[model samples]
Target: MKVAGRCGEGSEGMVRVARGPRSAAMPHLVRGMHRVLLALTACGVVAFAGPARADELTGTLKKIHDDGVVVLGVREASIPFSYFDGKRTVGYSQAIAMQIVDEIRKTLGMTQLRVHEITVTSSNRTPMLLNNQIDLECGSTTHTVERENVAAFSDSFFQYAVRMITRKNSGITDFRDLAGKPVVTTAGTSDERLLRSLNTEKQLNMRIMSARDHQEAFSAMKDGRAVAFVMDEPIVYGFKATDPHPDDFIVTGTPLGYEVYACMFRKGDESFRALVNRVIVRSQTSGDAERLYRQWFTQPIPPRGINVNFPLSEQNRALFAHPNDHALD
Candidate 1:
């Protein structure tokens, strides 16, 4: 069945072995025809939108619905996607996750459904879900075949190019410039793996320092321990913005690879997966997705009230025009 906007294929992409895991500033035409190309893309998941049946609840939905609570996996500083704004979980992805939670509440007919949060990192997000510690991981998680081999991912929301950032005087404008220099990326991430492959494939032999998180990766670059910090473009831009001297850093390099970001959960549970996808499609079609993007990416955001100042790219505009579940690997 053609269910929603530009739909993606089934989990036919990379999944990182252990694996894991848009906004709206939208346009007027996108606003009007947002629900145009959605189709049933994933192999078996359906987009059924009927009312939730308590007696028939299953999987994650059943556990949360029966328990009257939903657990969220949040990030410490993934910037516009999922991050702590000092006090609360706030970001574009976090907003989308909350929308999903609201749908859960409505579907289960539990208005006062209690919601809780757990901090998850690149290393622990999957284990937390597989271990049933958190119901949904809402952050900048990429959907890949290896990861999908173990856990499950929702439909794609953001697509980005993996790149690196460095000081203006670092003389590293591209991947070729970092031969044997120390470069940092968050551990347990696709970016780290990609960098590793590039180091060997291109014979760069650069020292790869895998930090525990983006903050630490940025710190390595900032303190001159690492000449460059490799990460997704949007994330590195956010990191660049966080710098006291944003002008000192520039996000540059040829796009080594492309990937899609999606919400993650345990494998199986097609019903709950369908619910999550439906919420994302609705956001895309109803313009909630675009609004969220504008709010987080284009406008000023929390913590330091800094504006990422990143505009919606045309490629991303297409994703919003037609949402998909496909992964880039």
Candidate 2:
């Protein structure tokens, strides 16, 4: 996919390997034994004989076990989802990603595991995952059929409505009012695609402008370069809360689209995917997910003491009740 915006900067890309006293050669020894077992099985020497070894883990888990490290892709300013709080990355997604890391430690029976963090943008997150540059992407990424062709998503963790943020008196109350008005959307985001499609399908004659990121998109709206900033509802709220004049803008208009947010990783990794889905499902059923949602959405968070104040929607409550990876269109 072609991403239009400049990616976020200032990621620590921290590489943390758990310190341990285990023999340095243990990983190598395990790998050697794994190869020998595979060879024997392939040669039919052990076919249908003896207990089968657990299916060799592939993708993220395999890489983590081999290298003793896992990489997580994060966002720099996605706020409440994934963002930098001072020098540390903190948000709802960050917390969940750590939970997955803990599960990996248990699954591999490893006393220590390393973690590496990398910053990813809307355009680069999927490509980084596909290239194995990152084992998992924990950011504000929407899952769509087109993205599914290149990567797989975990169970939906959050849902959003695509909406518009404009000055309170802009007279843009709905999609019909957007005709012939300049609108800004972050580059490489679903909002951009939705606006383009609306323009084509409904002949709205909207003048679309792409911003490098949400901050830039909001700047355009503030400076009168664009009459409206179009993006996911949570994100719009995030920006509005942080703006100096929070009361100046309003998120209005009927939703142009609905989005399901989930963590993304490489395709064809069923073992890894299943592990991720299990973690999400367990969190949902145990009420851990709801707690995290409340922490970020209802309560005040760091850097700024602003609360997004978004109550969990009924659609999302249903998703948590019965977690599944299926996309909600």
Mark the regions of model 2 whose C-alpha exceeds 4 Å error after superposition.
Answer: 1-55
- Which stretches of model 1 miss by more than 4 angstroms? 1-51
Q: Candidate 2, residues 1-329: lDDT per residue as tens digits?
A: 11111112421111112344667667987955655554444223455533223356666777888888999998988888899988788999899998888877767777578889998887778788888899998778998888888889998898889998999988888888989989899999888998899999999999999988777888899899999999999988988887778899999989988988999988888778767876787688667889999999899988888988889999889888877677756
Please give, for residues 1-329, the per-residue lDDT of candidate 1 as tens digits: 24333333422211111212233566768744433312232322245634577888889989998788999999999998988887898999999999899888877878999999999999998998999999999799999888988899998999899999999999889999999899999999999899999999999999999999989999999999999999999999998887778999999999999999999988998888878987887677566788999999989788887888889888788897787889888
Q: For every model in order, what is the number of clashing pairs?
A: 21, 0
True-structure RMSD, every candidate? 9.8, 13.2
Q: How close is candidate 2 to the true structure, as a TM-score?
A: 0.81
Top-scoring candidate (lDDT): 1
